[model samples]
Target: MDRAPFHPGPPAEVTATPAGDRWTLRFVRDLRHPPERVWAALTDPARLREWAPFLADRDLSTPGDAVLTLVDGDAVVAQPATVRRAEPPRLLEYTWDEDLLRWELTRTADGTRLTLWHTVADRGLLPMVAAGWHLCVDVAERLLAGDPIGPIRGAEAIGFGWTELRDTYARRLGDA
Candidate 1:
């Protein structure tokens, strides 16, 4: 498999919707992989380590409770989360800290359409969160393509690509 050069771009489509005092950030991406494959990456801890910002202590394939450890450089913060919903190869949702993360997958003509909806309590952190998810999805694509890259997270992620992507998303989200 041939891998394309890394492109630091915002998501294909991202929307911020205000609901009450919180905001929901939705990221849409069409991945060139099957839903089953994508689902594995989303729930499998070993695969997540290749792309996600956190590692799970247990399999998230079923609806239940699990611990997620947020990884940043050499730092780790463990948080308990309940799998609010789980439908294999289609949907998975859970709570992250004070927020909720929902992943929806659909089979597309060429591959799969992955949509991530994250609810955040602090609207001020929208830019940072959006940028981090952008990088995460990008890494996920690479990992699924058989050309994985090292994780860029924690202070490294917030200070690195997060800076530029945050500015771009901030502008797009009208938060600038």
Candidate 2:
């Protein structure tokens, strides 16, 4: 799909570690809902299953932040993550492995603008991660609006510019 990921604030920066070999993909979407409503979909396990499912048949949402054990039948994937930043509905940040993700939401005239930044320790994994996030965030948007969810995610650009998009959000927020 040729859907656009919308945002209206200054985008945060995601960089490589001291290793200097990491890839990070960030997704932003201006949602049509309040911060409290948006927070519910993110923190709630049942609500998260509707969107943000990393594995096809696994529940990744658990309150109080701990090592997440994701098992689909036999195979299992353990992800170490925590709620790094939580401010009601303003921001929610966390870390999974060497990657850090932050979703910052701001109240707007129309709705809330949510920006997600995902840092990957492996550059090769960018494409898959980006595409999956696109789909999940779109689902999240639909969920926030009380609308039917759809499966739609765009392809990842091999070389998606970061600063340009970040600057765009920064400018828009300034104007807003």
Q: Write the per-residue lDDT of candidate 2 for residues 1-176, one digit (tens) a residue.
A: 22355331233333322235655555667778887788777766667655664322222233345554343335557777776677777777777656777777888888887777777776545545544554566667766666645333222221233334434433433311
Candidate 1 segments whose C-alpha is farther than 4 A from its true place:
1-5, 158-160
Model 2 deviation from the true structure expressed as Cα RMSD, one decimal place: 8.1
Model 1: number of backbone collisions: 0
Number of the top-ranking candidate, with TM-score as the measure: 1
Residues 64-155 of candidate 1 have per-residue lDDT tens digits of 88999999878899999888899999999999778899999999999999999889987767777889988888888888988887666778
Model 1: weakest 10-residue lDDT segment is 1-10
State in Å the error of residue 76, model 2.
4.9
